[model samples]
Target: MDLPHFSILISDKQYRKLNRNIWSEKPVEAELQIEDKTFDVDLLYRGNHVREFSKKSYHCIFPEITAGIKEIHYNAEFMDKSLMRNKLSLDFFSSIGVLSPTAKHVLLSINEENQGVYLQLESVDRNFLKRRKLPSGPIYYAENDDANFSLHSPIDEDIKDSFDSGYSRKEGSSRDDKTLQELIYKINTLKKTEFERAILDYINIDKYLRWLAGVVCTQNFDGFIHNYALYRNSFTGLFEMIPWDYDATWGQDINGEEMEFDYIPIEGYNTLTARLLDVPTFRKQYAKIFEEILTYHFNKQNLYEKINVMHNTLRPHVLRDPYVAKFIDDFDREPGIILKFIDDRHHYLRNHLQDLR
Candidate 1:
């Protein structure tokens, strides 16, 4: 099936301004045409280091266009040869009942020039919470730089202060550092036994375990440290982990290197995971969750079928994508790599989880 089409119309002057300093957060006026409808939007170049690349990502705000749906993201997926990595990973998370931003493949054009096929992702903002029926709570994007869940700053530091520590609050009225600072304090100061109890008290353990399983199965090393969101559910009074920026997953590292199946540990990385594994109960639970994922969702056959469908859908557009076609030698071979990674990763995890148990 052909993917949906989205066209952004901007003046030559505005387009030049946007490309002049790609790192700028300056919003340029544009008209977004989706299907048969047109809406006015403010388009801005997004991404930390990706700004330096030719294939640029964008953040669009439909101020006078729509309600509830205020913003959307267009990810370039420049490093990925297959170009289906992010969409597939997010679909996998959703299939396993994880709350993640919705994504779809789209044939994108800027002004009248064909930009290429881009993954259009739903913004993980208040609209996300409303659509998912999740409780309204503070949402913080774990910034790409310092997303490590560690207590590196003083508790007294104003929550409003921008620290290179990499935490950016997206929602919530009171922007004081108290809520997050308290959580960090608890994570750092609490004893092992106390931490086990406190972590369970503050975060949803089952959801976290499932998220950890997804991260391990996908081999998303970057996700462990960054490119995720931690939201405190008002009703449950516990934080839930949300997946983000999965374009580099499925046997590839951040630098586009081919990753080995045995790279990531079954216990996972980060202090929170380390502390959780320290507890006997949490370890057993993790082992069980890992096994369940392999048996039910993370198997080679299920993944291969999904990959085949996406490959078939995207083959035409990928071949025509100017940016991707220039860099990738053989787009046909990309699906095989993902299939092999699934086979190898599943086999490795089966044995690894057994050893852990």
Candidate 2:
């Protein structure tokens, strides 16, 4: 079947205005036609550096059009030559039982001009929790690059000040970050032995191990520090990690630079991860998780098959994308690099799982 289509309509004046200041948060009123239904949506150009690119990413919010879903993100996938990095990485995370946003490729047109294929990502919000049958709790978006849950003195004051600890609450009515602050305090000050005993009380340890395994397997160095969502499960009363913005996965850095797949430590990133690895039990669990991922999800054959399917599905659309052609020299060759990376990563992990301790 052909991919889904999204037709966006905006006045010339509004389009020019939006084009003038593409980075502005001021959303312009636009009409979106999707799946034979027309809905009024507020469209705003989103992303930081990608906004400056030739093709822009957009965030669309359907206030009254959709009751359950409030918003969706259209990623330009500018830096990712494969264009399937984000989608594939999210799928991997979901396969391993970690909560992540659903993503799919869709052809997008603006003002009747084809803007090429975009990855449409489901917004992770209250509705996301509802759809997944997960408890609704406080959702925090990692806003900055310094989301490393480190042990900084005056942690409570920093949380009160909203310092660049990289977290911003997107839901719940609590004006103060007492819950997060307490978690950080425990992570930083609790004695090593005591913290090991009490860590699972504050966060979902098993789910986190899976998340860490996913990051390591995909080599998403940026994920551990930023581009993720942390939400507290009201039922479990423990915070869980959600993967986000994975365009730099599969052995490529965010800038499309080739990365060493074996360089990423099994311990992964952030203070919480380091502390977890400090415990022998956590390390053993992490090794076991890696073994399971390699045996099932992160193997070369499985990943290569997924890559072939995505590449085949997107080839025609990518060839029609003038914007992609402007940046990538040979779109056809991009998938080969990803395939090689997957094979190499699987080989490295399979041989190095013992070194994780």
Candidate 3:
């Protein structure tokens, strides 16, 4: 079970430039070596607080990498002992018919030093849409708490001066900004009846509900308000969600601490979800989706099998990495811990689903 290896070669000056400003999004010129072949790339440190970790994540842009991959991420998975949470979460989303980035565990080396096992994630950009043969459209990353689809700032509760406060337009035109702004405005201002009818014009209700179900089942507390991408489907003319950055999931908090299975509510948090569930039809739809997911996707047997496979796959590599070597015992126990959480969370959701009904 040899994982793919990626080696990065960057000039010391460029490397120093990246370290000089760890928070900077600016990328430094570098060369990537994969399978004895080399390609030019731009590299930079990624993640917010994870940047401070001893094992940092990275973002890379390849002017001409693979056919549809212009960029990719090498996540350190520093806060996740299993090192498979992101991959598992995203795979679940895709399996349930929600668009999500593909990910794989690979070994990374920088300056000829082993950086250990890294989860390589596909970037959510136009290239992502193209690769899937989906209709091209605007894509916006829910950058922060401000992306809660509220008229007021989630931080201080002040009216947002900018309509696009929490979103970064990943691929689209100025018109896309206006479109999202109008959607947000309507979500906050429209009368309940009007909102119930008009929201369908702005978002794909079924897809959104499925995405919500994925987040709820996975229990990504930060997902409702952030850590997702909203793609405006050109053909459908409605916004659909794509999940991102799910290391803190499956009964684990962002700090790799155990989280109670009931920590995140079944309906999830954030204004958009609240508003959507306010409608009876949408609530019923979501409840149905939850039932389906719980029965088929989030069950102990289904998830336990997946977790065991991932755990076994990483067993060979876990001790090889110095950063995670000390935690090998914890890693080995993660499958059971996660399985217990799933069992508890499944019961909790089944009981709670009736409340939604």
Candidate 4:
């Protein structure tokens, strides 16, 4: 079936509260008839488009939430801080080799009051979709549901199905090694294996293991991968990292430090970072990878700050931006379990730094 480049708005509200997707209301220019609620929506929550608004805020629409996480105020300020952290994380990946979206656009900016953010919306690269397409393929998304409080996930469905023979998760299923080994074998042979066919079976299995690491990291993001073929676009066929979903982000962790230490458990991609930083390995992985990636990005911009580079703020220009600058003050008021998390990871890395060399 042919898809339309645009969608019509059935209804929209100012969200005197929360509106995950940001759009300028002009008029709907699409011909539409609602059928059995096509998963594909011409315009849906978190739909992206390129437009020059008077406000011209840059936002990334995080199509959906995948966790049972409830919203809390004590940690809301972390969203501001975590945006910097996430941008830095993206910047960090770019410093190494992950060439996913550089995010020239602003993801979240503080509103006039700093009470909340005016999320900027940007267009999703269709080509990006091609690169990151799952073997199971993309799921059509819709934002309308009754007050059932149920969440839907296309990516989760694919991840779940990739486990069974077209059948998804069931209570009786045991996802033990035997099951994992079988799943990896099948994935290795897929026409477009998500991992690599060139590698041995263990490496293929490692890829999935890394994805489990991703689950842990993203459990922090509250986003399960949606369209991930390009999770992060690499310069080579050596699949790039993929980061999809937001909104559920920042609200989950009391302390915003999980992304840094997730690899201690090997839940992310097999970059040199994991090999060096994770507890199972040299253990200096987080500090080393953080040092390396942050150095690369900071140097690329000709900005150097030798302080806590992982938490370091590079762009004085960004820092000057009232929106960007709030991360500091807000983070202070924000009660993060992260201070505790940082201590935990620091304790681990401190214990293992010698092994990293």
Candidate 5:
């Protein structure tokens, strides 16, 4: 009736049901179902494979090709180039120990008016979770699901324990001081492991947390821990930190009243695993990365410059283009509506490290 909006058509790829890894299934390519037409599409994996191509329960019917898309390279009217630049700029800067990712070159397939930019990549190897294991006993406690702190209305600790512990026949150790100590040990062990040694790309996750501090106090950004985490390679169990989703990042007027704020940390230099950093190790390693950033694409000055450039670049054109005008109008009018969270998101990134100097 209403043009059917956007949808997705999956290629016959035999991917693992649990995780979205490239498995041996003699897979075909994916197609995009926009309205009634289907267009050929390529797969772009970001952060972890968990959400890659995973059908969202709500939007599973009329699937949008852009749904759950983290990073991609394309020549779409105004997409890829802009979005990719934002992502990769942060990413590249991140690799250099900046609180972002480094920019990988864009591979373009251009002709006249349509130049397709595909293949956005960098040398930062992916990593997976560490120290994950089968539950030994009851895991959650009655208090773990505090109403004041719960975000997703996590099932009560008893129910969670029951399901996790095969109907609560046994129990997992409590997160006592000893348990916390064990977690600390396990985290440290992984940090110095041969697996981690290989990824000595100088990941200062602490820096990102530090950046979040500004987001909290100044930007009032409601950044959360669960929103960001460390990634790891499945085979090797190495940890690579990433700050993926930021839809609910920018906060509005609040007296810092959210209990979740208390439960989940939004500041302080730390690890993706919520580990407090070794002060000396953290500073030395981070400084090395910062210097490396200076030696390369890590440009703090360039970040602010880029933001100012975008405001100017998009302003004149958006004035003439109805689509762009609407995009901005909707963002301002509803304030964090339409594209949902991108406006507040851009605000945070655009103004994140401005006070660094």
Candidate 6:
């Protein structure tokens, strides 16, 4: 299957500038070509550690393009041998009712040089909500562990300087930050009774639980405290989640090493999850979500079909990829790895469901 091809043309000066400051967030002027059309764009390196990889990821802002999208991300997925984990994980989240970013595989070319297959991800911003016909709201990215909904730093366990320490505002205003700050404060400072009553007003518990289930089932070790976006729904006045940077999922750790299916606890990590699960009613709701997903969505038989399709589609591409071509053998075995993880993870969670009961 031929994927959509994107060609980027940049001047030598701009290209040199990008390479000189590879770690910088500054975008250089570029022309992006899709099919027969060309549009001016701002292109820059994206991602944290992955930015340093030989096959770097990219962020592109289409100033002149009008496809109801302002920006797009091209993930190198350097650590993920299969290169399908991000899209697969996001698809699973969506299937289980979590509003994760949409992703697709596409071929990229820079200066007419083939850059191989890249996972083109939808940017989780205002446009994300708009496209889904969801209510417009303030969106913030959980950039690190401080986004853990605690007043302490996850790294050092020290009291945080601010309530919104781990988050970067992607959209919204100071008012949105106040709402997030208030939520964090209440989660940490409010007593048991007050918290139980006020928590529902601030967060969409059902959506959070489903997102937790998705994370646990997929086994994203770093997903709990970060790798997500928070959107405050205007109408509901409650915060919801959107997953991001899910390349290290489905039986693999962040380094693409094999991970035990039961590596992540069924309850998930993070203070918000801990506080929510502490409430008996919320725990039961979360347990029910786990049961439902395990019974229907997270099973090997059901997920293997999707896995096979993705694996087969990317197999040919992987063989030809410049960065991942050498790892084709590893890529070939990923379906089995993912499927086994699902089977084992399903068994583990079902047995542990009694804990919630």
Say which candidate scores most in lDDT: 3
Window of ten residues with lowest summed lDDT in model 4? 66-75
Between candidates 2 and 6, the lDDT winner: 6
Across 1-357, the per-residue lDDT of candidate 1 in tens digits comes to: 888989999999998988887878889889899888888999998888777788888999998438579898999988788888898899998877678888998989987689888999998888889987888998888875456666442244334333325677898755534677677667767898788777877878988988988998899988887879988898988888899999888898877779999999788887678778788898899888877789989988888878988888888887788888765555688899988999998998888887566
Please rank every candidate by TM-score, starting with the best: 6, 3, 2, 1, 4, 5
lDDT of each: 0.82, 0.84, 0.91, 0.31, 0.31, 0.89
Instruction: In angstroms, give how far residue 118 of model 3 lies from its true place.
Output: 0.5
Listed per candidate, the RMSD to the true structure in angstroms reads 3.1, 2.7, 1.1, 13.5, 13.4, 1.0
TM-score (C-alpha) between model 5 and the true structure: 0.36
Point out the higher-scoring one by TM-score: 3 or 4: 3
lDDT of 4 by residue, 112-167 (tens): 22222232222224333444452322212212111011122233422222322322
| Residue range 65-114, candidate 3, lDDT tens digits | 47668998999999998898899999999988899999999999988998
In candidate 6, the residue pairs with backbone N, CA or C atoms under 3 Å apart (3 or more residues apart, or in different chains) clash, namely none
TM-score of each: 0.93, 0.94, 0.98, 0.38, 0.36, 0.98
- Assess the local accuracy of residue 280 in candidate 6 as a C-alpha lDDT between 0 and 100: 88
- Model 2, residue 232: what's the lDDT? 89
lDDT of 3 at 92: 93
Candidate 6 lowest-lDDT run of ten: 62-71
TM-score of 4: 0.38
Candidate 5: how many backbone clashes? 19
Write down the RMSD of candidate 2 (Cα, Å): 2.7
Q: Name the weakest run of 10 consecutive residues (lDDT summed) in model 5.
A: 53-62
lDDT of 6 by residue, 67-110 (tens): 88899999999998878889999999999999988899999999
Off by over 4 Å in 6: none
What TM-score would you give candidate 1 relative to the actual structure?
A: 0.93
Task: Quote the lDDT for 61 in model 4.
Answer: 24
Candidate 3: segments with Cα more than 4 A from true spot:
none
